[model samples]
Structure formats: C-alpha cells, structure tokens
Target: MAVAAAVIRCRRLNIPRAFVISMMINAIQAAIGRSMDPLLTPPAGNSLHIKASSVDGVQIYTCSGGEWRFLSASASLVDSSNSSIFIGTYAYVYSPKHVSAIGTWSLNNSEGVIAESGHAASEVTGRVIAFRGNKFALPAFLAQASSHLFDGTASLVSYIQQIPSDGGVPPGSSSCRKGSRQVHIPFEADYWFWTQDRQPPSVPSELSAIGLMIEGFFGTGHVKYVFNGTSWQQKNITASMYDVPGGILVGRFFIESHADDAGGSFTWEVFNPNGWTVTAKSASPGVQVDGSSLPWRLFSVTSASFNESFLGPITQVQMISTRGGLPPTPMQAQAVVETWKIMLLQWSFKVCMKISDSECTIT
Candidate 1:
C-alpha cells in the first residue's frame, strides 16, 4: 500500500514524466538504490548507516559516531584493526622473494614487520571500502599479461606479520600481538583509514569522501596503481608508494621494484623511530651497484583475492575513470535520481498495483 502511495507522489503534475531508468535499480533491490536519499541527512547522531547500489555493484558507508568511514582494510588500517575486521579484496601478480637483503638490518621481525614467510609477491587491495558493517566488496583483478621470470628454486610463503613491539596484548606474553593478523601489509603510510568527516553539520556530498585511500606500490612487481581518494594512481615516490618510517613497514617490497639493474641488486632496510628494534636479512646474497630513484625501491609480491561479506558477494565496482565528478553541478546527480523515482512508480504500478494502460491512480 505504501508503494502505491509512493507511485502517486511520483505522478504529481509538478513532477517530471517517467523515463526508462538504468538497470541499477534492479541491482540494488536488497539495499537502497543510489538514486534514493539517505535515511539520515545530518544523521541524528553518529554511526549513521548509508548503503547504495547500482548496476556495477553495491557500496557502503557509515558515520562512526565521530566521523563517516568507508569500511576497508589497508596496509595501515590493518595494523590497529582486529583480525576479524573486513579488509577490502585484493588481486595482483605473484613472485618469490628473489634475494636476501645486502644492507644494514637484522631479522627480529617486531612491530607490524615480523615475517615468517620467505617468498614475496606484488599485491593490490580493494581501493573502495564499501561494505555492510562487517561485510565488504570482493575486489577483483586482471591477471598479469606476463608474470615475472621465476627461477623455480624459490619457495612460496604466506603473509608476514608483526610480533607487537609494545610487549604484546597479554602483556609479557610474547605471542600475543595486539594488531591485525595480516602480514602482507608493510607500513601505515602507504595506506590508512581516512576519517575526514568526524564533526559533521554538513554531510559529505559522496561516499568516497569518507573512506580509505589505501595505498600500494605499482610497476615494481606490485599492483599498477594505488587508490588516492580521487582515483587509482601509479605508484612511485608518492605517499601511496613509500610510507614514512615508524608504521607497519616493509623494506624489500619498496627496494626491489625501484632498483635499476631492475633485477640483480637486492637490499632491505627497516627504520622504526619509536624504539622498535631494526632488523634486516640478506635473503640470498646481494649488494650490486644500484641507482633506484630512492636507494630502496618498494618490493612487493603479487597476489589476488576477493572481498566477501556475510551479506552477499560483490561482483563489480564502478571505477573513477577520469576521476570523480569533480565539479558536481548542483542537482546533476539529483536529476537522474528524480528520473529513477518516476521509473520506480511505473514499475510498482504495473507489477504490484496491477494498474495498466495509462491508469496509474493518484492514490
């Protein structure tokens, strides 16, 4: 009955005529379609839930009582998050750690850098953090056209993790690390939870405004581009590529990629200003004449996986091709929404209300 009333509202003479809407409406039937208004405008308090769907797939956003957040796990967010928190899906090429470090460091592996694995591969996590509270979109990837040349003698391994430098969670118990169990993440600078909308009298214009701009390296055996809020950018010396010291840090991933001979030289270094012991290891035996822009190139093994949630599997994501609608003309998006509303009315009348042949009663 309420649907019937909604149809009438859409039909008011003051409103525009119904038009054929996109297939996105059907895609988001489980959640509010992107065309719909948010349930909460200023969102009474905080932690307001916002979900939208389109033909591409579903996206999620939330006001975390203090700010809006796009639920995603980046190399940084994972450092403090619980093991259960959903990180976005990942996809990338894979390769074994070629050689051991030939620099000044050891292998104690503390903080978010404790690694038990010997193999290394490039990686790419989901750029968007759209997901239901604990659920998320499974990021997909295009396989590398041609993978790197592997020696076949190298061994594959799982992700690396930190052992907790602050003495661990159980306090004094060495095995109790106080952060997420993910090991692949290198440092906090490359990726992080972007909480820009903490205090909001003015709500964000779009969902991307309140999500994670998780960063990763590109080219050097890593994913091609890193998400930089606006779009995925190719990794270089940019923040998305090289994180500042003292966070979840990975040395080899950065160094290996930027190296000049591009292959022959291997060096690893760990710099933690907060008192975490610095350690390095020469996986094989390196130390060649190197000239990477930054002595150390971000080295990452490639890997792939999808973001899955208890709600449903996210199959696709609409990427910001030329970047987002930077200069959002007021009501530009709203116009499409209005069109959708009219289409919805038409659908409800014909399918549910059983009204037909130009007979869509006002009530």
Candidate 2:
C-alpha cells in the first residue's frame, strides 16, 4: 500500500514511470540483499566471489522400472538484460558402484560468447568449448578448479554454488509408477561462481572517446562521459576496456558544482546486464588526479554480476586512476557541466561450460 501510494505521488510529481520503477526495484533488491541468510556466506579467505546469476530451466527425468530417476537438466543462464549468457546441462551418470552427475555450460552465440555472429559450425567442430562442473545436489554443487575437464574459462573457476531454489521437484511416486516416460520439471535457482584470482583479464582502454564509441558496437562496452563543470575536459582516457561485462561499462555520474559541493556530493549508477543491480559510491574525499588541479573522488562497485563470457563473472571494480570531472570551487566564477576521464580495474572469477562426474558432496 505504501509503495502504491508512493508511486502515485511520484506520478503526480511528474517523475518518469521508468525512473520510478527503477527506484522501486532497487529499493526492493536492497531489502532482499539485507535479508539474505548469513549462514550461506561464500567461503572466506583468498577465495574471491565472482559471478551470481539466476538460473531458469527444467530438470529432466526418466521413469525407469517402477520409479522416476534423474536424467539431465537443460537450462539457460540469463543476465540482467534478459539475455542468455551460458547454456547449461546437468546429466546424471549411472555407475554400478555409485550414481553421480556432471554439469556442463557453453557460451551462447552462433557458436556463442567467444565466437562471431553466424560463424560456421564446421569451422569450430572440435573446437566446441564447454566447462565441466560437479553435481552435489539438485541444481547445486561445488566444482573445484582441479576437477575441470577442458581448459578455458572453467579452468579458472575455483568453485560454484547454487542455493535458494524453487520448484523442479519430481512428481509423486504414483505418477512415476504409471508408465515409463520422460519429464521436464521447471525450476529456478541462484548460482554463484568463485575463483582464486583477484582480478579479471585486462583489455586495452580506448585512447580517444570516439574509439570507445566504436568499440561499444561489438558488445555491451560503452563510454558515458559525465560533466561536472564547464572547464572539465577529457584529455586521454587509458581505461577503455572492451571485454568486461555490461554493468562494469556503465559509468553514470551525477554532479552539481557549487560552494556546497563537498564530500559525498556525487552519485554513480550502474546496471548489470547479468541481472545483478549494483551501484557505485564515493570511496574517499577528493583525491588528486595527475593532470587536474581539482581532486576527483574514487568509487567502488557495491554489487556485481553472474557468469560472463571472456571475463568470467565480475566480482569487483575500482576507479584507480582519474582525471578532471571535479566541481568548481567558490573562488571559481563559472559553474557548469564538465567531462572526466577515468581508468577502471575489474575483478571476476573465470567461468566456463562443461560436465564432469564426481562424488556428490553437499556443502
């Protein structure tokens, strides 16, 4: 009721419906983040948390003899943009000794993520890339780096865990005993990827803003130049990365220059294409940039994404170096928007798609 009233008030105040919806979603997400169970915290130490995504798909099952046995699960891993990033399958392996399952994932493309559009199937026949994972439970497990079958993005992943699931339970025994058949039970769950690496692989930043604009054509890469004052000029930008996920590329800056512009005067908004809604905030008081007289503040990612293609899953991003984009002081006469240059450092876990069998161990 309160939310509905607030929405009505916002409409009366001439707020954009899209903006209002975005604000409400962010607020609700924040509350959900706060309510997460502390007991499910990722393993501590040097273990870096990387990608977290929601999985939407079906669990495959086959009726054998008088019972329905697990078969395989086929699903697509979606990002915040509602685009499928990874294609995954969980296949049950039957052994006279013990039953196990292997989970596999592949990049989504004509061949997918790492491949070009409309690429020929014959050209990449044996080169079909996928990451292998272990299954400890239904739609959940830990895949160690040492267990990866084919080397690639998955080779870099130290572990993966899925929790907080809904649906996908098999039908009752009465239904299974009726006849032999195959079934697909729909399910949704959250997945997380982890790695030992502290940062994602670096790609060259655009030397010129125009070049950055062109690069954005290839993928989600983009350069949004934010202005603080009229004097702010973006000279050389050395941090135009191309291979990072969508949210890491979004650099939305809001600045109002005046005498009142002091600490915590700026705000940045970033959205994850992998479905993780995140924001960046001022990390410190004004810090001196190399060429600019006025100091620009630093910001860090409050949240990140799930499994991405080349960079795996982004865990964190930091604005290590910056230039310009500072608000005017009281002594300065002109107060207008200006441009800023920044170099971003991104961290993520290496993720891949493949399947490997191992003893089921729930953790």
Candidate 3:
C-alpha cells in the first residue's frame, strides 16, 4: 500500500509537469506564428492607433503623438502623413481598398517629387516650382511670354497716338488759310499785314485773325485758330485791355455776319476745357441789345451776355452755334453779333457787355 501511494504521488507530479511542458511549447508556437504572419494578430494595445488605410507593408503603433514604432520586428516605420517629413520633400499616406496593409510610409521615397499618375511629365521631372503664400514660380521659358514688359500704368493706346503721328489741327483750325488771299490767317508776327492785298495783308475778317489782332492790340493775349471749312473760327479770345484789373477777356466771334439775321438765330454755347457748360445766344428779334430791337439790320452787331462767379481759373474755352432762319438783307438789318462779352468793372468785378448794331465800334 505504501508503494502504491508513492507511485500515485509521482504520477500526479508527472501530470503537472507534462501540462507545463505542453503550455510552453504552445506559447513558443504562438510567438513564432505571430512573427511569420504579422497580419493575423491585432496590434499591441497602448500602441499607436494608425488608420488601416494610411500605411502599407506593416502596422505602426504610436505610444504618443509624433512617436511611432513598428509592431512586427521585421517591418520598418515610415512616415505617411501629408506633411513635410524629409529634406525638401513631403509625405503622403495612401492605401488601396483591396489590400490589407497598414502603418506609416515615406511618400517622398516612393512617389518622388510629383505623383506618378496625376502629374504631367514636366511636373514629375521637377520642372515645376512652388512659392510661399501659395504662389507659383513659372518656368524661365514660360516667363518670357507670360511676364509683363511694361509698367502697370503704361497705356498702349495713348502711347501709340502720341508717337509723333499727325493728329491734324484742332477741329476749329480746319478752315484756316495761311496767306492774305485766304479768308482767314493765323495770328502771328509774320501774318500781320500792312495792306489788304499785300503778302502781310490786313488781318482777315475771320474770328481767328480778329483774335490775333485783338491780342496784338492788348499787348498781352493769345489767339487760337479753328477752321470751319469756309473760314478760320476764333475761340476763347482773352484780351487784357489797358487800365483794367480782373480784366480777363472771354468771348467768341462768328465769321458769317449774315447768319444771325437769317431768322435762323445763332446760339453760341461756351464750355471751359474742364467740361463746364455755359451758353450765350445772339439777340433775338424784339429783344434789346444796348436797348434796341433785333432784325434792325443783317450783320448788325448784337451782344447777348452773361456772367458767373466761377469763370475764374479758366485756361481754355470752346464755342458752338446753331442757326434756324432765312438770311436777312443788309439795309433791313444791322451787323449781327452772336457772342457773350465779359469785361472787368472798375471795382475789379466781371461786367457783361451788351452791345447793339449801333453800339459796337466796327473800326
């Protein structure tokens, strides 16, 4: 009985030992299996939680933010986030739906400077350049055509027009003639005439010539000529008469005296070069010019005038007219005047001059 008891004790001991041995063998096999097939086991806990789609080759575990380690000893760690991870290059994570790959990867190494499929040949070859602030640098060859050669404020149209090409004389100088035989002559020292028929004949009766003569008479004024096909039209005549302050002159003169009496009254519209509009009209029939009636005589001098506080600072002026009646006879009418005249008063204020056929001094 004693021997049997001892044998039973030994048997029990052997059973435990054998069980322990079996457990040891199974643990070794499990470890080997995990090493051989990395995908079968779940990644270790307390490790990085990498998205399955963000990596390939092996699973990566991160103990903390920005800290990563591989689960399989054989697999290596690769950064796969879309961030600059290498020198002068960036990383991008990618995973195909069909594959069971996981972990971080170095996108720069496999993908190169540009992606294989999405980028053009030039971009893949590193020809493309990028700049800060989301800017882009064009290739040198492309820059030759795309770059601006002129300053931002340069105007091609204005530059071309100003390139010494003839713009023709101002609209008003179209009718102006140079010599005494012509109806109009520009006011210049060379144009001053001693007689009506001579080379330097008397000033033409046209407004342009009259303006020049008036400038000579005032000793300090300028004359501009505009041609209306038949005669030179004078505009913006500024005459500084003797012994007058604030004496700036502004007026227009019509070459055709008969225009006013044609029942087609002339309307003179004045405008400063700055585009301010002002108007002056010829005295109408039954209207008073220096206290007289219109149609008194065709070519009769009549001055209808106006005044404004803002006429000062005026550097240039323009005039236009429209007529609407049959021409009048000389005896039946007086010399017609179709302009506004402003003269400085003794007090240095502007005073309008309203002259009639008899009031004006023709000589």
Give the top-scoring candidate (TM-score). Answer: 2
Q: How many clashes in each candidate?
A: 31, 22, 30
Q: Please identify model 3 stretches exceeding 4 Å from their true place.
A: 1-246, 255-271, 275-363
Model 2: per-residue Cα lDDT over 1-363, one tens digit each: 000121211111123644565475447446647223332322221133334344657777788776677766655565424445543333333344433323444323344523633422111001101232233234444432223433234434444445536666777656876555788888775555444433211211211011100011001112233333434333322222222221123333333232122333222233354333223344445444333322333333343334233323322233322322333443442432222233221212111111111111112
TM-score of each: 0.14, 0.34, 0.13
**TM-score preference between candidates 2 and 3, better one:** 2
Alpha-carbon local distance difference test for all models: 0.20, 0.35, 0.20
Q: For model 1, how does the per-residue alpha-carbon lDDT over 194-257 read when each residue is reduced to its tens digit? A: 1111221111122111121112111112223333333334342211111211113232222244
For model 3, residues 215-296, the per-residue Cα lDDT tens digits are 1001123333343433434443332321111112233232333434333233222324422222233322221111111111
A best-first ranking of the candidates according to their lDDT comes to 2, 3, 1
Q: Which regions of candidate 1 are displaced past 4 Å? A: 1-30, 35-237, 240-363
lDDT of 3 at 168: 13
CA displacement after TM-score superposition, residue 341 of candidate 2 (Å): 66
